[model samples]
Target: MTAEREAEFDFTHPFYQTGLAIGVPREDSAGILRSLGALLSWQFLSLVAGLGLLLLAVGSLLWLVERRRNAEQFGGSPAQGIGASFWWAAVTMTTVGYGDKAPVTLAGRLIALVWMFAGLIMVASFTAAITSALTVSNLQRQINGPRDLPGLRVATVADTASAQYLTEQRIEQARYPDLPTAMRAVADGAADAVVYDQPLLQYRNRELGERRLDILRNTFAEQLYAFALPAGSELRGPLAQEVLRVTESAEWQSLMDAYLGHR
Candidate 1:
């Protein structure tokens, strides 16, 4: 079925017709988790810590150079001098020279120039790292939407709505027999990304473990999953009724929570 027809049927289908059946709740939960994961990731945290340490080291060096030679501006107990050095380093690194604290010695000014350039590079690198990790929607700033599909090596399962959509869009794609293989193609660098059902992709991501892959928050072409039965089957109505009953039950809600927790 076309995505539009499938979406219409999903809203009316017994499996999704209950009053509590909100649409695409899993996507919202996944988004929250992804954001949390990015912020708490060890790699990003380590980079921040390293930058802080580097700044402190530079501050310490500055205090040593100015401790005896330029005693007026940096004179006092070692601790006070180090504190002043730190403040200078911070202000200079951020390119916000308040001019309140100036290094008088030639050695101090030379060190300041080096630290300034190093700080500039470090800041740019850190910003790039954050942008790469958190901006999951645009993979490398390439795949913003379905319209940006051309020239990308997309992967999707055969006989799925995603495959059909790719065909209609005339986007280059590698069709796999199942979701696992399609996802693997992306992980293995054979494809730029995998396009599939959002909930199923989220489940797969959980199974694969943390942050190995990213899913785009923007979903397109919604569709419903249904059980296929023989034409004019006598059991269809009874099965559908059972599905409706189970879906609305507390037990079923618990099961859903277990699999896909609330955001």
Candidate 2:
């Protein structure tokens, strides 16, 4: 779940305005860059694919060894035995052994021992890959609310509510003419993150795919959208009532679904 902090923007506060910022250490920058580079490298992808193929090959080998020798545990027709072998390989590789099946043969046990060690290496690589993917660059994982915006390169569209909010909070930001450009800044590494409307950010993130960008679940300084009217307009009350009525109807839901999907 997304964690939210208070929306109060204290412009006069030293923490919000200016101070000696405690940023990610420069010493760790090289390691973080290396990790990110590895994650996006072709070599890493090849290694992952090779490991997957190795798992399948080991599973097939196990099936060949146990199918005839131990028919009861790894029993059934050739196809079924192969399927069981795959199940066993998967469980063993993940270290989730159920112990319902085992190989009694010497050769099979030797293969299992080798596979166990290989699985350890594979698992360690997978964990490192996931960690590198998650902790990309210096933005560790503390970005939960607007208060965390200090010392980060933030982007937003110019002349929008988000831009105004950033200004009021005395937060440094890069302003773009449009949402796409602002989001692209984040993706291109020109900006560390983008702050904009939740729906627009969500739609853009979906379009860009999670690997390219992601939207933070928590939102701060929420504002209500309203229609503007001429001063002393008599139609205000009726219009407001009708707006509420229509928004509560199925038609509004259908419109939302058509535009933004169920998400």
Find the candidate with the highest TM-score and give its number.
2
lDDT per residue as tens, model 1, 126-200:
789888778853342255567666777788889867777789888877899987777766666567677777667
lDDT of candidate 2?
0.67
lDDT of each: 0.68, 0.67
TM-score of every candidate: 0.45, 0.46
Root-mean-square deviation (CA) per prediction: 10.2, 15.5
Q: Per-residue lDDT for 1-263 in model 2, tens only?
A: 01211222111111111111111112333455645664776766776787777777887898888878888877898778877887888789889999987888888898899988888887888888767664654344346667778778888889877887889999898899998788777766677678887766655555655334555556677544445555456766777777777777778867765654553
